[model samples]
Target: MNELAAQIGVEVEPDYRADESDPAQSRYVFSYTVTVHNRSTREIQLLSRYWKITQGNGKVQEVRGNGVVGKQPAIAAGHSFRYTSRAVLASPVGVMQGSYGCTDLASQEAFEVTIEPFRLATPNQVH
Candidate 1:
Protein backbone atom coordinates (compact mmCIF):
# COMPACT_ATOMS: atom_id res chain seq x y z
CA MET A 1 0.00 0.00 0.00
CA ASN A 2 0.98 3.63 -0.33
CA GLU A 3 1.32 6.39 2.30
CA LEU A 4 -1.93 7.92 1.23
CA ALA A 5 -3.39 4.49 1.72
CA ALA A 6 -2.04 4.71 5.27
CA GLN A 7 -2.14 1.06 6.17
CA ILE A 8 -0.30 0.28 9.35
CA GLY A 9 -0.61 -3.04 11.18
CA VAL A 10 -0.59 -3.62 14.94
CA GLU A 11 -0.42 -6.69 17.13
CA VAL A 12 -0.99 -6.73 20.88
CA GLU A 13 -0.25 -9.37 23.45
CA PRO A 14 -1.78 -8.51 26.82
CA ASP A 15 -0.98 -10.43 29.94
CA TYR A 16 -2.25 -10.42 33.50
CA ARG A 17 0.48 -10.95 36.07
CA ALA A 18 -1.23 -12.16 39.19
CA ASP A 19 1.98 -11.75 41.14
CA GLU A 20 1.79 -8.00 40.69
CA SER A 21 -1.97 -7.62 40.73
CA ASP A 22 -3.97 -7.06 43.86
CA PRO A 23 -7.47 -7.91 42.77
CA ALA A 24 -8.64 -7.94 46.37
CA GLN A 25 -7.87 -4.26 46.55
CA SER A 26 -9.21 -3.58 43.07
CA ARG A 27 -5.74 -2.89 41.73
CA TYR A 28 -4.95 -4.86 38.63
CA VAL A 29 -1.73 -4.53 36.74
CA PHE A 30 -1.41 -5.61 33.15
CA SER A 31 1.39 -5.47 30.64
CA TYR A 32 1.03 -5.47 26.90
CA THR A 33 3.56 -5.91 24.14
CA VAL A 34 2.75 -4.19 20.91
CA THR A 35 4.26 -4.96 17.52
CA VAL A 36 3.72 -2.18 15.05
CA HIS A 37 4.30 -3.10 11.46
CA ASN A 38 4.58 -0.76 8.55
CA ARG A 39 2.45 -2.32 5.85
CA SER A 40 2.65 0.67 3.62
CA THR A 41 5.29 1.64 1.08
CA ARG A 42 6.73 4.64 2.92
CA GLU A 43 8.85 5.08 6.00
CA ILE A 44 7.09 6.60 8.98
CA GLN A 45 8.14 8.01 12.30
CA LEU A 46 5.96 7.62 15.32
CA LEU A 47 5.44 11.10 16.79
CA SER A 48 3.07 10.50 19.68
CA ARG A 49 0.35 8.30 21.06
CA TYR A 50 -3.12 8.61 22.53
CA TRP A 51 -4.77 5.82 24.46
CA LYS A 52 -8.31 5.40 25.71
CA ILE A 53 -8.35 3.05 28.65
CA THR A 54 -11.60 1.90 30.17
CA GLN A 55 -11.99 0.21 33.48
CA GLY A 56 -14.65 -2.41 34.14
CA ASN A 57 -16.12 0.01 36.64
CA GLY A 58 -17.01 2.33 33.74
CA LYS A 59 -14.26 4.84 34.38
CA VAL A 60 -12.23 6.00 31.39
CA GLN A 61 -8.67 7.24 31.30
CA GLU A 62 -7.00 9.18 28.53
CA VAL A 63 -3.26 8.74 28.25
CA ARG A 64 -1.33 11.09 25.99
CA GLY A 65 2.39 10.55 25.66
CA ASN A 66 5.31 11.49 23.46
CA GLY A 67 6.06 7.96 22.38
CA VAL A 68 5.88 4.33 23.31
CA VAL A 69 8.22 3.40 26.14
CA GLY A 70 10.22 6.66 25.76
CA LYS A 71 11.10 6.17 22.12
CA GLN A 72 9.58 7.46 18.95
CA PRO A 73 10.56 4.64 16.66
CA ALA A 74 10.95 5.01 12.98
CA ILE A 75 9.42 2.12 11.05
CA ALA A 76 10.96 1.65 7.66
CA ALA A 77 8.92 0.35 4.82
CA GLY A 78 7.79 -3.21 5.41
CA HIS A 79 9.48 -3.19 8.81
CA SER A 80 8.15 -3.20 12.36
CA PHE A 81 8.68 -1.61 15.76
CA ARG A 82 7.90 -3.47 18.92
CA TYR A 83 7.48 -2.13 22.44
CA THR A 84 6.11 -3.19 25.78
CA SER A 85 4.01 -1.04 28.12
CA ARG A 86 2.02 -1.43 31.27
CA ALA A 87 -1.33 -0.30 32.59
CA VAL A 88 -3.08 -0.25 35.94
CA LEU A 89 -6.79 -0.60 36.35
CA ALA A 90 -9.26 -0.35 39.20
CA SER A 91 -11.11 -3.42 38.08
CA PRO A 92 -10.31 -6.93 36.95
CA VAL A 93 -11.56 -6.42 33.45
CA GLY A 94 -11.04 -3.49 31.12
CA VAL A 95 -10.40 -2.45 27.54
CA MET A 96 -7.82 -0.26 25.84
CA GLN A 97 -7.88 1.36 22.43
CA GLY A 98 -6.03 4.18 20.74
CA SER A 99 -3.89 5.35 17.88
CA TYR A 100 -0.36 6.35 17.10
CA GLY A 101 0.53 9.73 15.67
CA CYS A 102 2.89 9.18 12.78
CA THR A 103 4.36 11.08 9.87
CA ASP A 104 5.09 9.83 6.41
CA LEU A 105 8.76 10.37 5.62
CA ALA A 106 8.23 10.80 1.91
CA SER A 107 5.51 13.44 2.10
CA GLN A 108 5.94 14.82 5.62
CA GLU A 109 2.21 14.32 6.17
CA ALA A 110 0.87 13.17 9.49
CA PHE A 111 -1.72 10.52 10.21
CA GLU A 112 -3.26 8.49 12.96
CA VAL A 113 -2.87 4.74 12.88
CA THR A 114 -5.37 2.79 14.88
CA ILE A 115 -4.40 0.45 17.67
CA GLU A 116 -7.31 -1.98 17.73
CA PRO A 117 -9.11 -2.32 21.03
CA PHE A 118 -7.82 -5.12 23.19
CA ARG A 119 -9.09 -6.69 26.38
CA LEU A 120 -7.34 -6.70 29.73
CA ALA A 121 -8.82 -9.24 32.06
CA THR A 122 -7.36 -11.10 34.99
CA PRO A 123 -7.60 -14.85 34.80
CA ASN A 124 -10.99 -16.10 36.05
CA GLN A 125 -12.26 -12.52 35.93
CA VAL A 126 -14.00 -13.05 32.65
CA HIS A 127 -15.78 -16.00 31.15
Candidate 2:
Protein backbone atom coordinates (compact mmCIF):
# COMPACT_ATOMS: atom_id res chain seq x y z
CA MET A 1 0.00 0.00 0.00
CA ASN A 2 1.51 3.30 -1.08
CA GLU A 3 -0.26 5.05 1.77
CA LEU A 4 1.52 2.77 4.22
CA ALA A 5 5.00 3.19 2.82
CA ALA A 6 6.29 4.95 5.92
CA GLN A 7 9.32 3.47 7.66
CA ILE A 8 9.41 2.57 11.33
CA GLY A 9 12.39 2.05 13.60
CA VAL A 10 12.31 0.67 17.13
CA GLU A 11 15.00 0.66 19.78
CA VAL A 12 14.73 -1.32 22.98
CA GLU A 13 16.56 -1.19 26.32
CA PRO A 14 16.11 -3.67 29.14
CA ASP A 15 16.20 -3.17 32.90
CA TYR A 16 16.02 -5.92 35.51
CA ARG A 17 15.50 -5.55 39.23
CA ALA A 18 14.51 -7.71 42.19
CA ASP A 19 11.50 -6.41 44.06
CA GLU A 20 12.55 -5.42 47.55
CA SER A 21 9.08 -6.03 48.87
CA ASP A 22 8.69 -9.37 47.09
CA PRO A 23 11.92 -11.11 46.26
CA ALA A 24 10.04 -13.94 44.62
CA GLN A 25 8.78 -11.69 41.85
CA SER A 26 11.46 -10.10 39.74
CA ARG A 27 10.63 -7.15 37.51
CA TYR A 28 11.87 -6.98 33.97
CA VAL A 29 11.25 -3.71 32.26
CA PHE A 30 11.96 -2.86 28.65
CA SER A 31 11.95 0.61 27.24
CA TYR A 32 11.30 1.18 23.54
CA THR A 33 11.81 4.23 21.39
CA VAL A 34 9.98 4.35 18.07
CA THR A 35 10.57 6.63 15.13
CA VAL A 36 8.16 6.80 12.23
CA HIS A 37 8.85 8.59 8.99
CA ASN A 38 6.16 9.74 6.60
CA ARG A 39 7.54 8.65 3.27
CA SER A 40 4.33 9.11 1.36
CA THR A 41 3.28 12.26 -0.45
CA ARG A 42 0.37 12.91 1.92
CA GLU A 43 0.22 13.72 5.59
CA ILE A 44 -1.00 11.04 7.95
CA GLN A 45 -2.35 10.69 11.46
CA LEU A 46 -1.43 7.82 13.73
CA LEU A 47 -4.72 6.66 15.19
CA SER A 48 -3.90 3.47 17.05
CA ARG A 49 -1.31 0.78 17.70
CA TYR A 50 -1.02 -2.98 18.14
CA TRP A 51 1.72 -4.82 20.01
CA LYS A 52 2.62 -8.44 20.52
CA ILE A 53 4.98 -9.21 23.37
CA THR A 54 6.53 -12.60 23.95
CA GLN A 55 8.11 -13.67 27.22
CA GLY A 56 10.95 -16.12 27.88
CA ASN A 57 8.58 -18.93 28.65
CA GLY A 58 6.87 -18.71 25.25
CA LYS A 59 3.92 -16.76 26.57
CA VAL A 60 2.70 -14.05 24.28
CA GLN A 61 0.67 -10.98 25.13
CA GLU A 62 -1.13 -8.72 22.72
CA VAL A 63 -1.71 -5.04 23.42
CA ARG A 64 -3.93 -2.76 21.39
CA GLY A 65 -4.60 0.84 22.30
CA ASN A 66 -5.79 4.15 20.99
CA GLY A 67 -2.79 6.35 20.35
CA VAL A 68 0.58 6.03 22.03
CA VAL A 69 0.96 7.24 25.60
CA GLY A 70 -2.32 9.17 25.13
CA LYS A 71 -1.21 11.30 22.19
CA GLN A 72 -1.93 10.94 18.49
CA PRO A 73 0.81 12.25 16.26
CA ALA A 74 0.36 13.70 12.83
CA ILE A 75 3.32 13.60 10.48
CA ALA A 76 3.48 15.57 7.29
CA ALA A 77 5.16 14.34 4.18
CA GLY A 78 8.93 13.98 4.66
CA HIS A 79 8.57 14.38 8.40
CA SER A 80 8.77 11.95 11.30
CA PHE A 81 7.67 11.43 14.90
CA ARG A 82 9.25 9.62 17.80
CA TYR A 83 7.86 8.10 21.00
CA THR A 84 9.30 6.31 24.02
CA SER A 85 7.46 3.69 26.07
CA ARG A 86 8.08 0.93 28.58
CA ALA A 87 6.80 -2.64 29.00
CA VAL A 88 7.18 -4.80 32.08
CA LEU A 89 7.46 -8.55 31.99
CA ALA A 90 8.10 -11.17 34.63
CA SER A 91 10.98 -12.76 32.75
CA PRO A 92 14.38 -11.45 31.76
CA VAL A 93 13.87 -12.04 28.03
CA GLY A 94 11.20 -11.24 25.51
CA VAL A 95 10.42 -9.60 22.17
CA MET A 96 7.92 -7.06 20.88
CA GLN A 97 6.40 -6.63 17.45
CA GLY A 98 3.43 -4.65 16.19
CA SER A 99 2.04 -2.04 13.86
CA TYR A 100 0.67 1.48 13.87
CA GLY A 101 -2.69 2.37 12.42
CA CYS A 102 -2.35 5.43 10.26
CA THR A 103 -4.81 7.45 8.24
CA ASP A 104 -4.16 9.72 5.31
CA LEU A 105 -5.42 13.20 6.05
CA ALA A 106 -6.28 14.13 2.50
CA SER A 107 -8.35 11.08 1.62
CA GLN A 108 -9.07 9.65 5.09
CA GLU A 109 -7.75 6.27 4.01
CA ALA A 110 -6.42 3.95 6.72
CA PHE A 111 -3.29 1.82 6.64
CA GLU A 112 -0.93 -0.04 8.88
CA VAL A 113 2.76 0.62 9.40
CA THR A 114 4.64 -2.42 10.54
CA ILE A 115 6.96 -2.38 13.55
CA GLU A 116 9.98 -4.69 13.49
CA PRO A 117 10.70 -7.11 16.25
CA PHE A 118 13.21 -6.12 18.93
CA ARG A 119 14.81 -8.06 21.72
CA LEU A 120 14.90 -7.53 25.49
CA ALA A 121 17.74 -9.18 27.31
CA THR A 122 19.51 -9.14 30.65
CA PRO A 123 23.06 -8.12 31.46
CA ASN A 124 24.19 -11.59 30.57
CA GLN A 125 23.52 -10.87 26.96
CA VAL A 126 26.43 -8.44 26.94
CA HIS A 127 28.89 -11.25 27.46
Q: Judged by TM-score, which candidate is best?
A: 1
* Model 1, span 1-127: residue lDDT tens: 2344357888999999788988789889999999998887789999899999999999999999998899988899899999888999999999999988888888888888888899999888743
TM values, all candidates: 0.93, 0.82
Instruction: Give the count of colliding residue pairs in each prediction.
Output: 0, 0
Off by over 4 Å in 2: 1-3, 6-24
lDDT of 2 by residue, 1-127 (tens): 4425444333444444434222246567667677777766788899999999998878899999999989998999878788878888777788889888888888898888787788876657541
Which ranges in model 1 have alpha carbons more than 4 Å from their true place?
A: 1-5
* Ten-residue region with minimum lDDT total, candidate 2: 14-23
Error of 2 at 26 (Å): 2.5
Candidate 2 all-Cα RMSD: 3.1
Model 2: lDDT of residue 48: 97
**lDDT against the true structure, each candidate:** 0.88, 0.75
